[model samples]
Each structure stands twice: as structure tokens, then as C-alpha cells.
Target: MNRRLLALVAAAAVLWPAAPAQAGPATPKAPIPVDTYLRQALDGTGLPGLSAVVTHGDEVVHAAGYGHDSTGAPVTARTPMRVASVSKSFTAMAVMTLVDAGKVALDEPVAEQLPEFRMADPRAARVTVRQLLDQTSGLADGGVGIPAAEATGSPAEYVAALRSGHLAAEPGTAWAYCNANYEIAARLVEVAGGAGFGQYVRMHVFEPLGMTGSSVGGAAADGHISLFGAWVARPELRAFGARGGAGGVVTDADDMGRWLITQTGHGPQLVRPESLAAMHAPSKVRDYAMGWGPSDVDGSRLLVHAGNLFTYTAVEAIDPATGYGYAVMTNSAGLYDDTYEVLRGLVALTRGAEPPPAGGQRQLIELVLGLVALASVGLAVLGVLRPSRRRWRLIPPVLPALVFVSYPQWVSILMNGRTVTWAQVTYFAAPLTVTLAVAALSGLVVAAAHLRSIASAR
Candidate 1:
């Protein structure tokens, strides 16, 4: 599938709920069988494990887990899954905490706080704390080689690597979702808050919100899986270190309930109400606020964010106006919109509406795509073994290589003219990347064999 379609699928999963014209009276409706809905979603998506929590004001309306996790442990409300980019709001809140203390200014040039944040383009020097939070810093995905940094280093190293990278646009001119921007923001948290980034979040955001089951950097639960053609085990979590600011908070359904309650304007006041308001306010460049993006559900405003680290995918949505919010996490990653499905269903239930059946069409389409990829590989092998004299046949054998090699460039074009690295593509879409690589390699081998056969005949 093309990147645009993939993005739309992701977005639709999170924001496509059809809420009621007006929310029903504040009287709590009979509890929807959210546990049943989540179990059904897990079965339909073929996910090995899933966890979800729904909250209304300070009450946890529903919290449950379905299937089994990586280690064959029964997934539960206490199982800690990496929340992925949902961690962005935590980072934003951390920055806001600094803002609350008068240590950080939202619109001040980031370079004023961290002199080492320079990029190859001088314009990068003007990026503000607010721009970084809202993703308008022009850093772009792969600008600082985030995938590599995520794999082997700290957020500080990730920020340091960006010094050699160029900005994708003038600072504050456009919104380009970039983890590097958060990495910088996280480092600023360290400098301004006078604590390690993770330490700061734990002491302020996580603890203050009463999310006791959550932590900044901890081993992700074992048995995490990724879907290539089928479910396969993924590696255990590496030390996220400072990169936790971008996508590295781990929490369980029980704790997520508290986090959601806080977002819905309940729980402890971790940051001032005004700061929280600013964090959710849409930025000048896009519908994105600080770390959250705003969406409309019925007439109510829903703030949403989704996260994927290849092995795990998560999404959270909160309608602060209605005091309803939910978070979903899954063990496997692919095109499946299981998390969003649960979120939408729960949101519908909260509004006293019947939840729609979860759609498994994306999974089926991905399976078909995987089968086609395998067939291409077989065709390439057959062409090599049974060489044909028609030079036209060579075109078919060589085409897959060209397509796979250019996949990154095509994705960059699709993503609002922002550049992407092969590593980032592979990390985000492993199944597609692996299939293309196999097709490309097989095609190259076949094309070479065909050329040799033609030369010999000549």
C-alpha cells in the first residue's frame, strides 16, 4: 500500500468514530461490555495480545486485557506495554512543567537553552520550544537518524547527530512529524528541569498524575511480536535512555486509567490548567497541539495520538469535554488498526451509541499484498532457472529492484516533501520493507542470470 493510504488507515483507526449529535445526559449509561468488545477486536485482528482501559472523570469505567503476551503470560490491567508516541504528551507536559517553573519559555529559540542543538541549515537555530512540541521545527523523520539513535544510543546522542542534518523547512513554517524534535525537547527538559529526562517525567508528570504503574524507561514486556506474513517474536526492549521523550513511556491499563482521567480534567493537577490548555490548543501550522492532535467527535473535541515502534502499536483518545477517554495497546505491529478500533468503540459506548463492528479489511488486504510479494519472488526465481530469449522479459525481472530501491524516495515524496531514511521505513513498515527487499534481491539475481544467458547465446 502507498504511504498516504497507510497514513489514512492509521488516522481513520483513531479518529473515525461517529459520536452522537449531542452527548447523552451526564447520568452514566449502563456499562457497555467493553471487555467483550476488546476480546472480539483481538480475535478479529488476530493479535496475540491486547490491553485497553477506559475512564470517565476519575472513575475507570473499563480496564481489561485480551489474549496472551510475548511470554505466554495472561495480559492484564497491570501488564506494562510500551505506550509508544503516546509518550509525546508526557514529554510535552514535562516541558510545560519547566514552563510552569519559569525555567523554559515556549517561544524562545531552543538554541538559547541548548547551544549544541545546531543543524546544518542556519534556520534551525530559530526553532522554538513551542515549534518542537507542535512538530513545526522542520526536523523531519530521519533528519537526525532517529532509528539508529533509538537502536543504540541516548536521546542526547540523537540530538547531537542532528547537528550535521539539514532542516526540511524554515522553522515554524510547516509541520513535519519528527521524533528528533521530541528528542531535542527531551534534552531541553534535562537541562531546564535539572534532572535526567526520564527522572523529571517520573517525579513530575507520571507521579503527580498518580500513574504509579508507569515508568519512563523499563524493559518492555517479553513476547512482543511483529507481523511479517505471520506473527514473529520481537526483541526485548533496549534502554530507551533519554529517547524516552519521543516514544518511550511504559505503562499498564490500570495506570493508563489514571493518565486518561488526568487528561479529562480530573486527577491531580500535574501542570497548571492553563498550561494543559495550551498543550491541547491547536498550533498555527496544523491540527496538532503540543503532543496531541485535535479531532472532532460529534461536537466534542477529542485529542488523539498514536504510536508504533514496529513491535508494538498504541493509541489514546480523550474527549475532555465529556470526561471520557481510552487507551489501547497491542503486542504486534502491522497495518492492523486494532487499537483505534477499540478506542472508537469505547468512545461510541460512552456516548450511549452502539459500537460498530471492528473492520479486519486492512489485515486481509495486507495478507493479499504479502502473497503477491511472495509470488513475485517465485516468478523471479523461475525466470532465472528457465531463461527466455525475449529481452523484454528482462524488464519484468529488473523492475522489482528499481521499485524496492526507490521505496524510501517515494515515501519521502508522499510525506509532504520531507526526507525519510531506509531505516525509518524499515522500522515503521517491516513487512513491506522485507517483502520489497526479497523481491528486489530475487529480481536482481534473475536479471543477472538472464543477462549472462543472453551474452552466451550471442
Candidate 2:
């Protein structure tokens, strides 16, 4: 895929919530064909591996794994995978637990709890616990210094990095999804709860929810597949120690089912109903709650969260009204939205309807773009070898080359003023991006040579 298409897909994968559709009446005991649809989706999407689980109350209606991991190991419900921003929900719950204990208040200034939490912008002093969980603290993604800090830096150092950055808007005035908000919130948990952020989560959240296999700071699953069906391993976010609250929970599908059950008001009552309700309610921004987005799926108002860490993607959703929930995880990197596709298919099956065919047009478009880039490189070389007196002939190859070289800047502009890194471009769409880069550089070389030939002839 070209960079523009890739950016659009990436944005949709991360930013957009699934649209609400009218769902059929909930059956007290409905049998969903999760396994049948998941297997077909695995084949259709070209994913290397996936794990999924559907839950109703405390019962696991369906749980299964398809395909193999990077090591050629067979996938199972027990296979661990990175859940990315799904971790945000876990962090938000941890904070709520402290609130229930009267150890922290949602509306209190975060700097009061974690004294080191300061930003270069004075408006940051007014940032509160609620704003942090709701992603309205004004510390936009691109400016957060966590991207530059030690991947294993302490929470204090993470806060210091954030302190050096400026806010994108006044606190509580606008909504911006910033990881720094969670990092600071996690730091508050460390200070108030008097334990390491990960340890605190393990004790208060994972342990209580009976999620024994879950933990924070684990590496992303190894066998992440690219859109072109090539195996690519994404580097573990070394800074997970600092940003664990934002996107770092690692767990298997079975544990995820249990977690989902709790969220849907079934399973163990680890958290009080009122507290969970608060987390699920929309914050000042109508689009996002604490860590979840309220979306309507098949007539059910489902609280959903989808996560992408470039290497692995995950989606967890619950319909409290129906006491049903599901979670899906994939070992792949790109803008394919595999998690959403699988979840939607399963949800449709539960409603006794067939989902439309999985979309593969994006992948096909990318393949065509890759071939076009190669063809441009070949034509550029040919033009250099046999210079055309008609300089206008240079426009075709030269124009695309210029566009390709300047594409990153365009992407940065589109991504809420965040700078695009070479590593990010390579991770999101490696095959097409690399080909474009090579084609652009080669085309420039040929253009230079062709211009020299014209000048020499004169």
C-alpha cells in the first residue's frame, strides 16, 4: 500500500470505533459459532496466528486458537499475546480501586498525588486523575517525552520527561489521546498504593480477577505477520516500564475472557458495580470513557477497546445489558484491523446472521502499489541510460519520486501534529514503504543523470 493508504488504515484501526447496528433480542442461552467463523477468518485474512474467547456470565461459551506462532508453535487459548491499549482499561480500573479506598480522588490534581507530574505548560497543574484516564489532559501523543526516555525508566523519570513537554490545550478543555496521561496516572498508583505499578496491578486487578497468567512489561508476541504474509517481530516497548499503564498488558485469551466477564457484570465481583459504571460512562468527551469507547454493536451498547502496538493488535468488548463479552488477539503488525473483523463476525454469528466477506481489497491495493513502485524504479533507470531530449518525459518518474520523499511530512500533518519516525513507517507498512523509498532515491539519481546529459548536449 502507498503511505497515504497505510496512514488512513492505521488511523481507522486505532481511532475509529465500530459503528452501532441494531442487534436482535438477547437469548438467555444462545450458542454462538465463534470457532467456525474464526477459523474461516484466519484463512481469509492471512494472519499467522490468533486466539479468541467469548464469555457469558462466568461461562466460557467458546475459546480457541488458530494457526501457528513465529516459532512454528501451535496457538492455543493459553498462548500469551500483547493486548496493547487494552491495558488502558486495566490501568483505569486500578485507579478506581484506589478511589474506592479513599486513597485517591478522581477530580484532584494529579500533581498533588505525584508531585513530580508537571509539564512545561502551566495549564498542566490543573490536570486531574479523571482527565488522565479520559485522555483530555492536553498532553498530546507527539509531544510526550516518554518516546525518548529509557524504555525501562522509572515512573519518576517518565513523569520528568512529560514535565519537559508542553500541553496541546488547556487541561479539560479538549480531548487528545496521550499516553503520557496514563504514565502519570500509573505513577500516582505507585505513589499512593505504595507498590510498583506492575506489582500493584498484579495484586489488585489481575489477581482479584483470577487472571493468573497476565502481567505487565512482557514482550510483544514474537510471530507478528505483515500484510504481505511475511513474519516480522516487533520490538518490545522497552519503555513499557514507564508507559505500562497506557499499553503494556500481556495475557492469553482464556484470562481475557475472565477479564471480560467481570467488565460485563458477571464473573467475580472484584470491583464494585458503581465504580465499574463510572469507568464505563462517557467522560467530558462523548467519544471515550476511562479507557473504553462506547459503541453500539447489533443493538447492544457495548463498551469496547481496541489496541495496536505495531506488532500485535487486540480488541475486548462487553455488552453489559446482555451479560456477554468477547476478546480477540492477533500476532501481526499493520492496519488490517484483524481484531475488529474477527469480533464483528463472532458478534454477527451470535445474532444468527452471517457477516459479509472479510475485506481483502486493502491488501490487494498495497500489492499493486508495490509493483508500481518497482516499475517506476525500472523506468527511471532506463531514462537515465537513454536520455530523452523531451525533458517533459521526466515528469512521470520525477513527480512520484518527489511525492514519495515528502510523504512522511504529509503523514505527520495528518496525525495531529505528531512527527513520523522512520521506524514507525517501516513497522506499519514495511514492504510498500521500503519499495517507495528505494524507488524515490533511484528516481532522483536517474533524474540527476538525465539532466546532466541534457546540459552536456547543449
Candidate 3:
């Protein structure tokens, strides 16, 4: 999954009050049945498992989970699930701590600080730490060694491979959401903080907010995708090599509540308000800050970010206007993202508006594809047993088969040139992939039978 797609959350025209009411006794909003809404989402969306946390200031208003994972374990707020690219915000917090300690200069050229971040592009020499955090370094996914799969082995090897990476634009000239930005930022924290990236995050980010013993990596739940109205579990095709900041952080709703509290300017301050402000502040080049993006929900503003992996996806949002924070994580994903839909409903709940009902889109689409596949198989079987006179029609059916052959290329084009591997298409687009395969294979079988019949007639 291209994690960049996770941004903008709902394209949300989410409403927020202009300011906190003052000078009168506040009428407390009645408690909303967050559980009822979440349960509805789980059943309607056909998500195998869902977990979420809602926070108002430092208080956890709600934290719970629904359904069960592939292992038959009922998902709960405490279950470690993959938050995917949401981990970037945590990584940004870790680096900001180093910045406070005067160890990492935000504007210093990355090559000067670490010396390992060399690139064939001379413009890479000007890439700054702040630019890396804000995703304006112009380093793109096309850069050498940027893909998590390509950078295997230890953290040192990952950084070493970036020596020949190419930049998409000059530093600070534009904003592009490249995972490599966070990967390099994580490596910098390791070198500057004198600890591994995971340990550094644990020490500075999680542990400070009273979340002790929590680290980056864990045994994340098996992710699932919808196929013919059933959930099919799929293993992640690639391990985030060295597990940098970009993706592959296993956290739960319980931990997420505490993290959100810190984000919304409550609980213990991990970084000073000024430092946190930097994380939330939008870059001049784009609305994206370090790991967060600014969005206007009507007249009010909210800081939002999203996470997407093949099997699992997540989204996080903070309403600075209301000091309300939300985190939604799911253990499954597909071409359509139900995870963000749930988050949108949660935001509506915060506004005292009923969360509008949503679900069934994925199931409906998959069912139609399944029927088409069945019809293709049935037609081909009939054609083989009782041959066709016009064999020319068989050739056109074979063309759909080429899509299965060039599956990755087709998906990459759809994703705006982002790389989509063969194994990945099976998870997010399984039903569509199955339908195409059935149609193509049936074409070949029918063609062969008709060709034999033509030879006999001759």
C-alpha cells in the first residue's frame, strides 16, 4: 500500500466549535455509545478485527476492540496491532528529543551530521534534518535503497545503501510523502542518541508518558483482506528492513490513548510545547509538518495522519480546537480503506453528531467480481465439452490473461508510479485478481478446445 494515500483522513469537512466555551457552566455532552458504533463498523465493513481509542484532554473517554484476529484472539485495546505509517509521528517525537538536547541541529545538512547519507545527486548534500522530518528533502521513493524491502540487514546497512540515492527535487523546494524521509530520520536518532531506533523511541517517546516497557516492534496480528465477502488473512510480503520509522510499529488502542494525550497537549510533556508545536506546525512548502498534516475541518483545524500496509491500516487525528484526540487501527486492508471511514464516524461522535452509518461497499464489489469469475469458468467448461464454430472470439478473452501476467505494472500505474509487488496485489485486490485470473485461464482453455475442433473439421 502507498502510505501517502492515508493522508487527508476523510477529506473531512469535519466540524469543530470556534473556541472552548467560557464564562458559563458548561453543559456536558451526553455520553455517546462509542462501542455500538464501532461494533456496527466491524460487522458492516466485514473487518476481521478493529481497535480504537478516544481521548479528551488527558482522560481516556474510550478504549476498546471488537471481533477477533486470525488466531481467534479477540482484539482488545491492549492487543499489539500494526499501526503502519502512523509510526512516523512517534519517530518524529524521538528525534525532537535529540533536537532539545542540542545533539541534532534541525537545519544542519544531514550529510554533515551523519556523513553516511551520501547520494549521487549533488543536491542531496543540501538535505537538512528538518526537511527530512517535514518530507521536503525531495528524496523520493524512486531513490535507491528507499524501499523497505531493498534495505536489508542492520540499520547501518540501510543508511549505507542511500549513498547513491537520487533526489526528486531540491531540498525544501517541495513536499513529497516518501517513507525514506522517516527511515533516515530514525537512523539519525540511533547515531545521535547512542541507541537503536526502537530503543530510542521507547526511552524518549513512549516511556515519558507513563507507558513503560513499550517498544516499536512486536508480534503484530495477521492482516486480512475481503474476498467474495469473506476475510482472507495474508502475511506481509516484506519485513520493514531494520524496522525504521516509516512503517511496522505494533501498538494498540490502550497505548495509543496515552500517546494521543501527549499529542493534544495533555499529560506529561514529552517534548516542550514549543517542540511539539514544531511537529504540528505545517511546512511552508506543504501543509505537512514533521509527521502530521494540517487540515481544516470546516472553520476549525485538525492535525491528521494515516497509516497503510497491505494487510493492516491505521489513522490518527488531533483536534487542537477541542483538545480531543482519536486513533483508529484495523487488522485488515483492501483496495478500499474501511479504517478511515471508522475514524470519520468517531470524529462526528466527538462533535455530538450521530456518526453516519457506513459499510458493505467492499463486499458488494467483491461479490460482483466473484459472479463474473464463476460465469467465466462455466462458459469455458461448456466451450471445451461442446466446441465453438467461430474460434476467433477466443482470442479476445485471452487478453484479460495478460493483466494477470503484468499485474504489478497495472497496479503501479494506478498508484501513480508507486511500486506494487505481485504478492501485494493478492492481499488488497484478491477478488479482482481472482476474477481476472479465472477469465484469462478460461480463455486459454476454450481457445485450445476450439482450435482442436477446427483441425478436425478440416
Please name the candidate that would achieve the greatest lDDT relative to the true structure.
3
Considering lDDT, where higher is better, how would the candidates rank from best to worst? 3, 1, 2
lDDT of 2 by residue, 1-458 (tens): 11113354654344334656859765454443677678888888778889999898888888888888877888899888888788999999999999999899899998887788877788888889999998888878666654574344677777776767888888888887667778788889999999999999999989988898899876445746474555576564334532478887899998998898888877687667999998998876657899888887666578888887767778888887777788988877664566777777777766667754554644654566577667877877787788766687666557657867777777676665555556666775566577677777777777787788778889
Worst 10 residues of 2 by lDDT: 1-10
Give all TM-scores, in the order shown: 0.86, 0.89, 0.88
Candidate 1 segments exceeding 4 Å error: 1-32, 142-152, 226-229, 236-242, 296-301, 377-387, 412-428, 441-458
Q: Write the per-residue lDDT of candidate 1 for residues 366-431, one digit (tens) a residue.
A: 565578678877887787788876688789777888988788787666555444567556544666
> Which regions in candidate 2 have their CA more than 4 angstroms from the true location?
1-6, 10-32, 150-152, 219-221, 237-243, 298-300, 390-407
Model 1 RMSD vs true structure: 5.2
